[model samples]
Target: MKKILILMLMAASFAAHADSFVKGADVGWLPQMEATGYKFRNAQGKEEDCLQILKDLGINTIRLRTWVNPSDDSASGHNSKDETVAMAVRAQKMGMRVMLNFHYSDSWADPQQQRKPAAWANHDFPQLLKDVYSYTYDVMQAMKQAGVTPEWVQVGNETRTGMIYPEGHTDNWPQLAQLINQGYDAIKAVSPASKVVLHLDRGHDNKWFRTWFDNAKAHGARYDVIGLSYYPYWLDGRPDYTLSINDLAANMNDMAARYGKEVMVVEVGGEDSQPQNTYDMLMAVQQKVRAVPDHKGLGVIYWEPQGARSWSHYELSAWGADGRPTKAMEAFRAR
Candidate 1:
């Protein structure tokens, strides 16, 4: 009993030390933007490496998304495994931690659509399970070989309804659990220290989160982190952060207590046109996550903060029209 106690205490100490607030950004569109000659400037109005600009803004972590057999289109393609490994190595060399998001699709996978990759379209249920495990392990192993392991690996991106469509859909809870577990097991196999995240959309919807997580528990889904995407601009009736900030905080607290898991606002952003409002929103969100009991709140990440609206036509980016980051980026520095 004494030996077991010592081991447990050591584990707790390690976990405590490892629990640092993660300030991150998902710059999945960065590589494409750069290739197309989209340059980024620092506050000083001088051209700088985009990663350095992010680092200067106090970003300690970088999130990259990977797709399977993507097309070569500039808008929707080129997050292949090779590119992901290269990006991971680059971010690690810049003294930043990395988070890998697996979309498990050829394009974006989210609440509206979770289409299977074309190669996976005709696969049977059993084969799809193997595919998930094999593909996940392959990318993880590539990262390992490249000398940069991610701190967090997401099994799927914004999978509110579920991923891989009908086969792994929430309609069949058992199968969805199995698919998630396959990715979880594969990630652990390659990088045992890495935390596996199960991500979903709509961070402020407590009732939906509870029901989804309850079903996850009942069906035996495994994940170390409960990742959420909190986008006020996208919310139907509630278009302001103030309207949902309290609910987001409560949901974070409730998820940590109920599931015994760490929670992270893995994806968040405000309108670039409203820099001050976006900055305020970011500050508020950070405070709420930091307030989670026992340091269970991992962190918040801005999705595509550097993807300027002029280039990507995305409104939620933190970058200004002139290629410099907007005031919203300062919130990370404030901490």
Candidate 2:
């Protein structure tokens, strides 16, 4: 009995050590932009040094989003694939792991919008699947050539409504699974060590998670991680932050246990323009995430701190107008 107790104690210590090493942030584009003078510092003189600042705050990973083609004119606009690979390379140089989020479109791809890339619009469903596979493979190859192999690859972003939509809807699990599998296969072909993540919105809804994942499994969609997007104001109408965080963490733990996969709060953040209440909620959520078991919970990622009203020309701001680290960022550190 004494020997068994000793073994258990050692196992517990190992688990704690593992958990302590996994804190991360999704600040991929921020750092690269910091070099270009897109500031995010506050009045305290905390400069918008994304990578260095995140490293100082215990962040070990970075996530970047990639789009197929980002401009309607095609003459001058952001080249998402190139920019993402550049960011990944820089992150790796900073000793942080990279997770590439493929939007599979020219612009933003989310639950409400899954606009097909112009090149793939003419293709039928089967042809589109092939295009997905080929595009994924080509991108992986390009990243590898650039010496920036990602640690994780997301087939699509916030795909609860399904990606490349009209055909890849949630109800068409079998076809969607095949498309996802193609992406997985492409990633494995280059970086076999990389993990494949299946991302979805609606982190607070446990029933939605269960149904979605169960259906994916039934369709033979193999994935290494379950990614969730949690936005308090949008997801929960009342905006009760504490309850929402607790609920999300609990649901994540439950889903991990059921699916035998690690959980990632892949996209999570509140409007920086909001008061201390929003910050408090974010911190509470981080605390709850940290308390989860190491084998189940991986980490939480803050979506886009620089995209806030203070820094960008884009309206519908998510960040504050001051270009400083909001209460939400401090909450991210759980300090």
Best by lDDT: 1
Query: Candidate 2 lDDT, tens digit per residue, 180-242?
Result: 888888889988988899998989889888988889989999789998888776854756666
- What value does the lDDT take at residue 28 in candidate 2? 40
lDDT for 109 in candidate 1 is: 94
| Model 1 per-residue lDDT at 116 | 97
lDDT of each: 0.94, 0.74
Question: What TM value does model 2 have?
Answer: 0.86
Alpha-carbon deviation at 76 in model 2, angstroms = 13
Tens-digit lDDT track of model 1 for 1-335: 99999999999985764446889999888889989999899998899999999999999999999999988888789999999899999999999999999999999999899999999999999999999999999999999999998999999999889999999899999999999999999999999999999998999999999999999999999999999999999888777899999999999999999999999999999999999999999999999998999889989999999989899889999999888999999999975
lDDT of 1 at 4: 100
Worst 10 residues of 1 by lDDT: 13-22
